[model samples]
Target: MKAVALYGTIGSLVLTALAAVPAGGLTRPDTAGAGTPAPAPPRIAFGRCAPVERLPSSVECGRLTVPLDYAHPRDRQITLTVSRARATGGPKVRQGALVFNPGGPGASSMHFPMYGKTERWRKTARAYDFVGYAPRGVGRSAPLSCQDPAAYAKIPSASPREPSAAFKRQKYAEAKAYAEGCARKAGPALRHFTSANNARDLDMLRAALGEKKLTYMGASYGTYFGAVYATLFPGHVRRMVFDSVVNPDPRQIWYRNNLDQNVAFERRWRDWARWVAKHHKVYRLGTTPQQVLRAYDTVRARLGHRPLAGKVGSAQLQAAFLKTGYNDAYWPVRAAALSAYVKGNPKPLLRQTLPQPGGEAADENSNAVYTAVECNDGPWPRDLRVWDRDNTRVARVAPFETWDNAWLNLPCAFWPRHAPRGASQDPARFATDVTDAALPQAGAAHRPVDVRTAPGALPPVLLLAAERDGATPYPGAVELRRRLAGSSLVTERGAGTHGVSFGTNTCANQYVERYLLTGRTPARDAYCAARAEPKPVLPAK
Candidate 1:
């Protein structure tokens, strides 16, 4: 699952109030020629939702059975769990459901509707029923899982470090074994756990929700999901707000994206390091970015031989610091942990990261789903030599996360290529016609998405990007906005956070409120300054 979060800075829309469209209507032209939707599926059979700890008591949950393969509607079925919070109707008729996805490709979003309960969503919650659902093979939706939750811990993550032939063999073997484990343990879902499949399932969900057009807010990887859905079912999308946009470059998919991630994370780390160095007197870790990174690197080196709490290894230590890459909020906390560990007390970093023994390890199912989607979404270079060369090259410059994220997705190289019926869909080639008899062939490598068939005119789509987001960087929004006509690009000028919308920046959230509730996007592409930097955190007592 991709790491995600809130808040970033810079985008200005003329708040010179244009007459807000009737809350129910959008100014976008009709989608008449786009295509027609299938008849509404049997109204979702709503059942009593057992209360969950965080969800509102009145939020209802239901399950919808969708074909595992849209190619064969009668084939095996999988169910997705959906949750909803009914809008508090005001003077106007409700504007249908506002679907949400918190991203991950693995994060359970059953509680997404809870955003409506928070003040962030206060201005617009009543305009639409907020709906959230666990996408296929994710939390509570016939989850995809592996046999070993500790799989990642057993092997060292791919290293940006130059590896010997022996290390290469070990990585290859581990990656192969990990992929096989998913096939054996995750069962039959691997073949179908793809964005294309999920996009189809979402259409079915849209049908079940009784909506001819869909309104959605998808973050991080969820934005990719919505993109796939829009590409697959363009006519059905009414309004979409994509936040912390995932790179939709058909050429990058998972591999090159991770390469970009290496560059981004190291850049973000430097940002944190500089910030730490700025507050050098208070934390006393270092007085320059180089010095702070050296101190941090020293701690990681020590963890390489001795894992903290026997669970937080060098890789785990780096993972713990990733929050700082997402936003500055965790700077003090991670800085404190880093400061404490370097000063002979390792407990704070341990408590902050691996709270319990083995807690830092990824959950079995989560890792499994992360693998399922990334691997299945597109083809990976299967040649170990290719991987070695590319990774060795990336290490020379963008070294920090190059190998770690590489091995994170390496399982795909060895994933079972032969499906029970045939090959899986060719993500590059749009599934204009899916068929059980002749599903797209997934060769060892595939081509980039054909832009000739890219998504077309529709509603004015909105995209949110931060100036320096590590996970889903800003360039992605540029590429996507070009492809999605009438889409407006909004930048948080200095916001470093990944998931920027509906969070800390009043300006960004205000834009979201305007678009989602008033059907008014920024008058033009806009930029908002990031909120003032958060003050340093006081170390825990």
Candidate 2:
């Protein structure tokens, strides 16, 4: 769930007209000795139906049948759930479809069509059908579920530090057992849950919808889904807006990303501690930021020795801390809870949500899919020594969240299936071929494409980054923009949350709305300044 953050100082904003390059220039020639080029995708058929079980009259639902594997179309088929909000305006000026994806490699998009009803979205909905699809292994589609909900309850919230050697042994044993349980229960579909497969499925949806191209807005983990789809079916994409981009480096994997996330969160926590220091009366830890930090560490260390109230152990505390780092909105709530817990009044902090037991089935499903896609797309360090060294270094610098992240993904060490081989990374094939003069010339130098996979042609994409995001640091977003050619990045300078859409900032909402409504892609990279005050007002009264 880690994502690229959108932050830092205001960079120069310039607009320019980008000339569309020839299709051949954007795509790599198929070098494989091919008998003949594959034919274009078939035209799709559509039909209307009554509203889905619980949706409003305005929302319509249908099912699309897609091949289980594009490579073997006749082999098997799977069902995909699709929802739509029809255009509301009188006469359509442009006919198109706008697809939506919410993060949660596991979250459902069943109700996403209703998002089109928001005031900002109303303008775009006039000429387009706002579409939402629940991908395979998720809601409405054939879902992957655990047989026992109670089993999830027993898994225990992440407790990275076992009090005794016996406890450590038990934790590792339990993690391994859970992994085996998934292997036994998840069936063959588990191996097919990689993101590349998901991307293929998305293309099928596009073909099924009878649309010549795909227009999409994806958030959080959704951004990666969009990126993968764009990479695989570039010609099929009309416009794409990837908010809170995920790092595409497959080597880092989930575990390494989480380790980086821990460090980022700790830095943000210190910033919050400083804010708490200023308002000492509301929730006083200490008068200075340093004192607040020391106080917090003392409380964490104490919990390490003995579980708070004989229940909230050091591990649970760490998990809670990581969740708190997601949004600035939760900082005060977490601060108050931490202050009370440190004072021996742990009831307030006890409100934290614990990962359910046996719930590892769902968690594993999501985690497995996350890892499978990443691992399949590229290789990872097969060496345990490398992980040990990295974990040790991460633990020293960012102790609070590191170990918990390690344990959350420790199962990857013994993943049952071999990592999938991917095409070599060819930056030119996948990204735009714009020269330096076309790009913004400030900030960190963009990271070279690291994955050694065959690059596919990708369409022009709109990337969104939030300034204060703790998980995916802002630098990651800037780096992603640099690597992705022809992609325009819109920075939400002050938005503190990870995902940019769904009521974050008007600037973000307006920019996205304009693009989706009129195909008015920003002339160049732009920035959406963080909202200075609540309830942004329209231009003038």
Candidate 3:
């Protein structure tokens, strides 16, 4: 249920709602069917949400009216919000527009233009207009919301078996209430927010920009978006860079995916505990890993019955624990905080704020759009018994996170709507008859842009799995590369993190940058070595 990016506020509602399925359950519609070829790119028609005079000269913002359904281009229209920062160098050097997406099925790309200002990006800044936008049902675009923050905050956390059946019943009731609340508040739009629609919108954006092709960069969930776009609009693509790619296998749902994360974190937690034990002088939890782990579990168990001063409860603890897997930089801080809480001072832990609430309106908007899209993309088992069996199996191996993840996604058990049709089981077949003129040349160089069609397209995409990644597992990356036809494997070595870009190794950064800027992929699916922190020098006395 943890949102994936800075736009976490909007995404939290949808992710939490959909996280109930097993891994790969949210497969999007295959792009293989007959549909009219996409229309030619549209000319730019700039319009302002606010007066243009008040806008900053460096930013160009506007809205474009697109079809609510591409199949009926002349029908109902919705306005999509967009923003751009023009290239800093002279016009002669401009390379065209480069669009960016920071992963979140729901994240806003509206601020992506600013990334060009960074030292790494500035090198390429002179050549392209950096573009950003809010996806449908997200920020400043007909936004969604739920009315109650307290109601959402009160959702119970996962816990161990309790003495009474009454307690378990209360927990179940709480989950049901949250699901019902969302259904009552979110209406029709809740059924329309699929990834396919978003992809269609991206193509529409390409048209409005007057570009013959799209050049893009996407991360995490954004990678999935980029992949689908390539499948649907292969000809319109000039170049694409996807980092920390999500596997496209259809069986793994968001909830099932968390089970993989839980197992990964359990290993990481033990590793952290061992380190804490070795440095007992700094953190006096214990002098051995087992002792320190016991101490940590003791704190979790104690909070289950009585929350720490009514603020830091088991749910909050689990949320915080899950967040630790996102980055190694957070490990020591989290350990210190946990040690402090176990020793009876809970203020630091309690003070950690939850993601900013989108308020009732935004929550309903997000929830509605999320369900509309996710449920429509694939079919989830409607039988509670199936979930019961799957979750029980998962719980046997990953006791810490399975049930909590299950309850987080309980809304799907009673999802108010269903997808238009069930997803196809077979991989979609590409039409060989589609003409070359229909496809744009891969770049100025005439290289075929369809990576999937190349011998290397199925080659191992450099998988940067973090040792302690909680949302997506390091092993998942390994498995993904293994499933890929010619993939070679690489580890972050010892890095414990989520998205590998901006947060970890310089070596990893260099590898990714080289691939993006020069298309020089790692020679054999290499792993960037882990970066170790430098030891502090004590004054020589």
Best by TM-score: 1
Best by lDDT: 1
lDDT of residue 240 for candidate 3: 67
Which whole-number lDDT from 0 to 100 does residue 324 have in model 3?
54
* Alpha-carbon runs more than 4 Å astray in model 1: 1-40, 51-54, 91-93, 150-165, 186-188, 355-362, 419-456
Per-residue lDDT of 386-476 in model 3, one digit per residue for the tens? 5566667666666666666666555554454323322222111212221212321111011111213233433234445555555556555
Ranking by TM-score: 1, 2, 3
Question: What TM-score would candidate 3 get against the native?
Answer: 0.76
Every candidate's lDDT: 0.69, 0.57, 0.55
Give RMSD (Å) of candidate 1 vs. truth.
8.1
lDDT of 2 by residue, 1-541 (tens): 3342222100000012212213322211122232222223444333453444367877877887765544345556677778787777756464677777776565556676776677756777777887877777765466554234355434224354323456545655555555455456655555455555566666666666777678887776666666656554556678888777666553343444566676876676666777677767666688998888778777777766776556666666766666546666556667778777766677777666344444455554444444434333333333344445666677677665666665555444444442232222221222322121231111111111231112345555678877766767666576656655667778888555666654658888877777666666675578887754222111110
**How close is every model to the real structure, measured as TM-score?**
0.85, 0.76, 0.76
**Considering lDDT, which of the candidate structures 2 and 3 is the better prediction for this target?**
2
For model 3, state the Cα shift of residue 471 in Å.
2.2
- Per-residue alpha-carbon lDDT of candidate 1 for residues 62-122, written as tens digits (9 for 90 to 100): 8888776543456577788998888877658588989887777676677777777788886
lDDT of 2: 0.57
